[model samples]
Target: MSDILFTSSATAKNGRDGHVKSSDGMIDLDLVNPAENKEGKGSNPEQLFAAGYAACFDGALNLVASKKDKQIDSTTTAEVSFMKDKEDGGFKIGVTMNVEVQGVSPEDAEELVEAAHQFCPYSKATRGNIDVKLVPQAIE
Candidate 1:
């Protein structure tokens, strides 16, 4: 029952070590698995997901700041780890978002980041499904 603003589709062949192409042909990247004996080099699903999530979260932070009538210069660094879920017997993702806001107090930056977590679609979708840690910092 939600209004769809936009949708993105991608096709991947050969699982983790393969090629991925988007429906819009904007993203066509070769994937390489880092778990192999050979050191293959290329992009991976986790990296892509982390990039997308970081950008989306930053956008959400900006939205919240705007609503609060505050001007913030911020940067979001997301570190995503892919690990084995011992309980689930499969792989899972863990996200740590390091957010730095310039010209803002640490308390205000923390508040903005918390509000962003509530507003970000990625955060909403991953809530309760993954472990996400938000670290807010203020830069002078």
Candidate 2:
């Protein structure tokens, strides 16, 4: 099945690509090289996955907090570790969420973390289908 809502252009370099669209229905894509400049500057699949995972998990955490009637005052950072699984022919993704919720007790934090894990879209998607791990910790 071909799914074409709109047409777009794409540019890729060093595994890093960019996607952009215009009002005239023109889309442009560019590939970025994360390691083009330096060792840590190169772009890789792991980095892209990490970015997606971090954003998704953080948003889920916030939603969980809101549902618990708790206000998250500080920032929530996510560290996604992508490990290679040679036998599986795919990489394993591990998530470490460092939540900065001040004034929230340990129990409350644990609750929020659990809720986040349950509610995170990424977590659900990556769970079972792919190898994923979560380490939720509060920085109060």
Candidate 3:
């Protein structure tokens, strides 16, 4: 392991049908499978993953823009889908990140998004393991 920057810990009980709590007590929530969550009462793993990835990617996008001396306001939305895996007869997850960038040209926005995909930790982690689509839009 390289030099540790930080570590986050969370504990989950009863698999996908119970509860999860962070070690820092910042997160405490019920877990429900999306297929079983008819009333939308609790959070699912896919939703959590989407939130994390979106936030991370947005930060990375801002960082990349700053390095290029471009001031940009950006929002990233990560849509995560859980689907059946035909190869293994199991399940897999895919992501589509929609990024809206202001204060930049359309071409620059697209380039920044591409650079963020290469820089973001979450993107790097899921690069070869899953499918991720990046959509960049420039706003006036």
What global local distance difference test value does model 2 have? 0.62
Q: Which has the greatest TM-score?
A: 3
The per-residue C-alpha lDDT of model 1 at residue 10 equals: 96
Is 1 or 2 the stronger prediction by lDDT?
A: 1
In model 2, state the lDDT of residue 21: 33
Global lDDT scores for all candidate models: 0.93, 0.62, 0.94
Q: Summarize candidate 1's per-residue lDDT along 1-140 as a digit string, tens digits.
A: 78999888999999889999999999999999776624787889888999999999999999999999989999999999989999979999999999999868999999999999999999999999999999999999
TM-score of 1: 0.95
Q: Candidate 2, residues 3-79: lDDT per residue as tens digits?
A: 77864343443444443333454433343444353444334555556666777777887887887789875455666
Q: Which sections of candidate 3 miss by over 4 Å?
A: none
User: What is the Cα-based lDDT of residue 81 in candidate 2?
Assistant: 60
What is the clash count for each candidate, in the order shown? 0, 20, 0
- Candidate 2 residue runs with Cα over 4 Å from true position: 1-40
Error of 3 at 39 (Å): 1.9
lDDT of 3 by residue, 1-140 (tens): 78999999999999788898999999899988978667767888898899999999999999999999999999999999999999999999999999999999999999999999999999999999999999999999
How far residue 84's Cα lies from its native spot in candidate 3, in Å, is 0.6
